[model samples]
Target: MIETLAKLVSTKIKTGVTQKELGARINMKQPQIAKIERMHTLPSFSTLTRYAAALDLSIKMTVESIIK
Candidate 1:
């Protein structure tokens, strides 16, 4: 899940928004964005929402029972 989130962030960043710019939009810093993008850190739910908003994206979560 974290890896997928990281990939999502990377894809958004590749859409012409630099880490620094995205961070500025989210009131964070480039290093923090880098850490999240590199999967070195996992952001909280609120932070994740902020990232999505900054990139004009949305998050959708689904859960399934593994025991099924």
Candidate 2:
């Protein structure tokens, strides 16, 4: 989960959006965004949503049972 989140953030950052700009949109600091992108910390669900929004992305979650 953490790796996936980091990849998503990195992809967004590659699209010409600086971490500082993204943080400004989400009311966070660049270091906080860096931590998230580096997988140094995991954000809460709400914070994840805010990150997605700031990156002009949306998150979709689905649950499946391991047992058939």
lDDT against the true structure, each candidate: 0.83, 0.81
1-68, model 1: which lDDT tens digit per residue? Answer: 67557666776858988889989999999999899887788788788888888878777788889995
lDDT of 1 at 48: 86
Error of 2 at 9 (Å): 1.7
Span of ten consecutive residues with least summed lDDT in model 2: 2-11
TM-score for each of the candidates: 0.78, 0.83
What is the number of backbone collisions in each predicted candidate, taken in the order shown? 0, 0
- Where in model 1 is the C-alpha error above 4 Å? none
lDDT by residue (1-68, candidate 2, tens digit) is 67558756776758888889888999999999889777788788788888887777877788999998
Worst 10 residues of 1 by lDDT: 1-10
